[model samples]
Target chain A: MLEINNLHAKIEDKDILKGINLNVKAGEVHAIMGPNGSGKSTLASVIAGREDYEVSEGSILLNNEDLEELAPEERAHKGVFLSFQYPIEIPGVTVTNFIKTAINESRKANGLDELPAKEMLQKIREKAELLDIDRKFLSRSLNEGFSGGEKKRNEIFQMAMLEPKLSILDETDSGLDIDALKVVANGVNKLKSQDNAVVLITHYQRLLEYIVPDYVHVLHDGKIVKSGGKELALELEAKGYDWLK
Target chain B: MELKEKLVASFLAFENKVSVDTDSNVHDIRSNAFDHFEQHGFPSKKDEEWKYTSLKSILKHDYNVFPEGESAIEFATVKKYFLHEIDSYKIVFIDGVYSSFLSETSHDGYDICLLSAALKQPKYKTVVDHFFNTIAAKKSSITSLNTAFSKEGAYIHIPKSTVVPKPIQIIHFSTGNEAELLLQPRNLIVVGENSHVQIIERHQSLSGNVVLTNSVTEIFANKNSIIDYYKIQNDEKSASLIDNTYVQQKQHSHVSVNTFSFGGNLTRNNLEFFQEGEYIDSTLNGISIIGDKQLVDNHTLVMHKHPNCESHELYKGIYFDKSTGVFNGKVIVEKEAQKTNAFQQNNNILIDDGATINAKPQLEIFADDVKCSHGCTIGQLDSDALFYMRSRGIPKKEANGLLLYAFANDALEKIKIPELKTRITKLIAKKLGVDLGFDL
Candidate 1:
């Protein structure tokens, strides 16, 4: 469902993502693990079309469409979603309203009519129930004064609502307690299907136990040095990343 | 002749036209104000308060001090300017002349009528004599200019213990019958003890002619009274306004003034509040969004004369396409005013490189026990926030608009009137060039 060919990206003349290549088919879950400053987040941001990162030489494709020329919003319209590690706090926009706007804007770009208000509410209710989010919480401002777990859960709520073809969870497990992490992982596992893909980008192997991935890739010095199965996560966790270095 | 000299020469003719009784107090006040205007002429950029805002270009117009006559305007033509969605007492003017046909004034338990009537009527003379120009700045040259020609405007009086059922809307529409015109409107509001009132004022030019307005308003909030005043300055690019509003709060009184400046060639708002007794609360909030060389300057001052008083001030500006904005907030805590709490904040977003914002916060606390804090910020929108919103499927333009709206939402949230809030929300959305798709 997603393809990255010799992905070379940099930020402000400093190369962050060296030569790297990865491919994931639909319905498969992939986990990209690395230590600090290992370019795990940069890879996710580059796939989401963050303008700050320059793709020096590489190409990304989603469903056979070249995403190099598309804007972030256009790529989102084409079903690419990035759950930010640190969510922005928009003081005036309620979470429900933000998601509503996002959903309607995507629909508008795809030449679809706005969802009926009743249906939208029903979907919101269902999604909130799925994530165990309070109804009142949906009315509050987007991520303003929200706890870390609440922010991660809200991001998952958005992913569930949009139902994107490819979802990249960039450090969604960090800053979350065990209980909150379980909720987020459970939601992601339930949302997985044959027509979609999930890419987990994390620094630790703790999340791998909850939402197990079909393939594991260790990113080091801006390159994917190793690729293996789910057992490789336990091996790496027990021995630590220093052994690979 | 220069505009100042012409105004000086036209004073005699203006006095003759009004035909004021020279022996009365009103005549004395007008002549004295005229003398002050003549002495100071127009403030130059050399003055510290006027340093950022220059009146040189605006004063060059050879304006007709008084319009020829009442140019009748249809309600259909100017209906959009009013908050027509709800019931309101409207005092509308056309070409500096009161339009009785378009106005709805009341005298039921309270007075909501024209200033001309209040100045001339024997029954209202006592109230008018006591409150008229009592709180306005005596040294402000432009304020004095408005006082010199203060003949007709809105006059509202809420009786003691009475709460006004509807808001009073004072709108001045310049018909542009002359090539260049100048209007001076004087408003007087007196809220009696324990009474409450809400007022909304706007200055609009009907045609694309050069129009300059010098407006002055004086409000008195009696003991335990409450007042909410809103100023809407969204006029044509050929229009400019100089608004001077002074408010006096008695013991236990609460007053708030919200100014929304969206469009104009140049707009300057001088708002001042004076706490006369203890436990007075004053709030000053403003939102200005301008582009294309438009300028909006807000100069505000709050003086705490008694102990246990509080003042809150917030002003936000969004400038784009070479627009200029200025915010100068001054808070003074007198030596006798102990335990005073005063806070001031000004935040600005300049959308273009050419857009400029000059913000200054001046706080003077003579009392040792008082708490005063002030902050100012001027920057562009957060690029990370922009990317965050864009990645959520909202386009870049919409994302920018949303962020700007949120930045200005703090002041907008203070609007008490629901319909007016919705209207202003729509206006801000329109100003930001986004639909927003729903009511904020």
Candidate 2:
């Protein structure tokens, strides 16, 4: 579902992702773990086509299509979703309206009609219920004055609504409590199917216990140096990452 | 002749055309006001209050002091300018003359009629004498000019303990019949003890003819009365407006003024409030969204003379292209006005490199125990927020529009009338050139 060919990326002349390669198939969950400043978040930003990073010499392919020339919105239209580590607060825009605009813009890019109001409302209610979000919360400004747990749950709610082909969860578990962690994990599991993929980027092994991963890749100094199964995460948590380094 | 000279010369002719009693007190007031205006011609840029705004170029035109012949305008042609969703008492002026056909006045419980009628009728003579040009700024040359030529405008009087059922709308439309025109409209409103009223005012020009309007309004809120006044300045690019509004509040009266400026060549709003009694509340809120070399300036003042009063002021501006804006809010708390709470805030966003805004807050507090605070902010749109919206598949332009709308939302939230708030929101969206899909 997603491929990175020796992704050589840098920001402001500082090389962050150097000679990294990875591949994930549909219906599978992949976990990328790394220590501080190990380029985990940089990799996610590069895949989402953030303009500040320069892809020195590499390619990011989704369904075998080159994404270098497309703008961020174009990539978003092509079913590439990035759950930001620190979501921005957009004042005066309700969460429901934001989601509606996003869905309609994507559909418009793909030459589809706008979703009818009733169906849109129904889908919003269904997805909101799936994430256990309050009805009043949807009417509030998007991420404005929201708690960390509420923000994470709102992100999961958006992911459910969009149903993207490839979803990258960048540090989704950092601010969640145990209850919020289970809720977000359950939401991701329900949305998982044979036609899509999920990539979890985490600093600890705690989130993996709820979602579980088919494959685990340890990134160090801009390269994936280790690959194992779910047990690898537990072993790393017990022994720390210094031994591997 | 220059516009200033023509106005000074035409004051007598304009006065002769009015049917009011020549020996009345309003006539003396007009004479004194004309003298004041004659002494100080149009304000020069050297004046402190006129420092940021220059009227030299706009006054170069040979404006017709009085509207020539009345041009017939259809209701359908100007219907869009009105708040047509609900029933309203409309006092509409076409080419500086009251259009009886377009007006819906009432004398049932209160008086919502024309100033010309009130000036002539014996029943309304007392109201005309007491409130006409009573609280106007005597030193402002532009205000004096409006007072000297004051004849056509709305006259509203809410009796004691009475409430007007419908909102009042005062609209002035310039027919563009002359090459260059000058219009001066004067309005008076008096809310008796424990009364309430809401007013909406607008000035529109139909064509590309050069139109300069100098309008003045005086309002008196008696004890425990409530007043909500809204000014919508969205005119053609060829139109320029200088609006001076004076408000006086008695004990426990609450008054709010909201100004929304969307389009015009040059617009200056001078709003002043005077608190005469104790425990009064005053609110001043404004929003300006303009682009393409347009200019909008808001100058406001609040005077706290009594004790235990509060005042709040907030103004927001969004400038695009070469557009420019200015916000100058002055608040004063007298020595005896203890326990006064005053707050002022001004926020602006410059959308383009060429856009500019000048925000200044002036506060004078004489009472030591009072609370007075003011703040100002001027910045560009948040790039982080833009990126967030763009990542959600919204285009860059649409994202910018949404962010701008968001920045102005706090001020829009204070509007009490829901329909007017919706209309203003739509106007902001339209000014930003995008559909935000929801009312903020």
Candidate 3:
């Protein structure tokens, strides 16, 4: 469903992602694991069309369409969703309102009618129940003064709401406790389908235990140095990233 | 002659036409105010208080000091400007003349009538004598100018221990009857001890005519009274307004003033609060959103004369194009006013490179036991917040608008009136020129 061909991207004259290649078919969970400064997040951000990172070479293709020229929002319209490592705190915009705006804006771009309020509320209720988020949490400002675990859970909740074709979870388990990590992973697992794909970018193999990846790729020094089956995650977890370095 | 000289020259003829009891105290007050305005004329930019706001350019117009004739305005034509959501006491004026057809004045229990009626009637003579032009700033030439012509405006007087049944709305509409018009609306509100009142004031120009409003309002909140005052400054681009509002609070009284500036060519607001007793609370809040060459200047002063008094001030501005905004907030705590708590904050966002914001927060505290803090910030939109919103499938323009609305929402949260809050929310959205498909 998504293909990255020798992607070399840089930010402000400094190369971040260099000579990276990855391909994921439908319904596959791909885990990109690496230590800090390994460009794991950069690859995810580039695929999500973050404008700060210029594509010095190669292309990111979704359904054989090159996404180099599309905006971040355009890429989002084309079913690219990036769960930020640190979600932004948008004060005065309620979580429900923010998700509604995102959903309606995407629908508008796709020339679809706005989701009916009743149906939207029903979907929100179902998703919130799945994530175990309180109804009061939906009324508060988006990510303002939220706990770390709550922020990560809210990100996964947005993923559930958007139901994107390809979802990139960038450090989605960074700040989560054991229970929150389980809840987030459970939500992602429930949302998985044969028509969509999931890309997990993390520094640890801890999240891989919950949503087991079909393919594991070790990203090091701006390139995916190794690719293997799910056992590769257990091998890397048992042996530190220093061994690979 | 310039507008200042024309007003000075036309004062006598203007005074002679309106016959008042020469023996009354208001007569002498008017004469003294006229002399004060004549001496200072129009404030120059060199004046410290008027440094950022210059009346020199706006005063160049040939404004008619006395727009004598009344032009009829259909209530349906301008009904949207009113707080049509709820019932209100409306004192509406057209071309400086009271439009009874469009006004809903009250005299049942509390007095919600015209300032002219209060000044002329023997029944309301005591109120007129006690409160008329009493608390206005004498040093402000523009204020003195309003006091000199302080004849027609909304007069609201709530007796002791009474709550006004409905909020009063003072709206002045200029119908473009004259080539250039100058309107002076004088408002006097006296909320007695333990009384509560809310007032909303607005000035609108119906046509693209040069209209300048020099307005003065004096509010006296007696002991244990509560007052909520809102000023909506959204006028035609050809209209300019200089609003001078003075609020005097007694013991245990709370007064909040919220000014929402969304339109107008140039708007200068001089809001002052004077605390006379202990445990008084004064809140000053403002939100300004403007584009083009429009300019808005908000000058505020809170004087803490008694002990155990507190004042809070917050003003936020969002400027686009070449629009300019000025916020000058001053808090003064006297030596005897021990335990005074004063906080002032001014934050601004410049949407365009050409847009400008000059924010100055001044605090003068003589009391040793006082908690006084002031903060000011001038910045552009947060790039990180913008990208975060855009990354969520929202366009850049809508994202910026959403962030801007969020920035201003901190100030908007202080609106006590729900309907007014909704109206101002829509106004902010419209001012940002974005259709976020939802109300902020």
Per-model fnat list: 0.71, 0.63, 0.69
Model 2: per-residue Cα lDDT over B81-182, one tens digit each: 999988999999988988888989998889898887888888887888777887999999889888887777899999999888779999999988988989
Candidate 1: give the clashing pairs: none
Q: Which pairs clash in the backbone of model 2?
A: none
Model 2 alpha-carbon drift over 4 Å, by segment: A220-225, B438-440
Chain A (candidate 3) TM-score to true chain A: 0.99
In model 3, residue pairs whose N, Cα or C atoms come closer than 3 Å (at least 3 residues apart or on different chains), thus clashing, are none
**Model 3: DockQ vs. true structure:** 0.76
Which prediction has more favorable TM-score, 1 or 2? 1
Q: Could you report the DockQ of all the candidates, in the order they appear? A: 0.83, 0.69, 0.76
* Cα deviation of A17, candidate 3, in Å: 1.4
Off by over 4 Å in 1: B21-23
**lDDT string, candidate 3, A65-176, tens digits:** 9999999999988999999999999888899999999999999999999999999999999999999999999999999999999999999899899889999999999988
User: Interface RMSD values for the candidates, listed in order?
Assistant: 0.7, 1.2, 1.0
State every prediction's TM-score relative to the real structure.
0.98, 0.96, 0.98
- Candidates 1 and 3: which is better by TM-score? 1
DockQ of candidate 2 compared with the true complex: 0.69
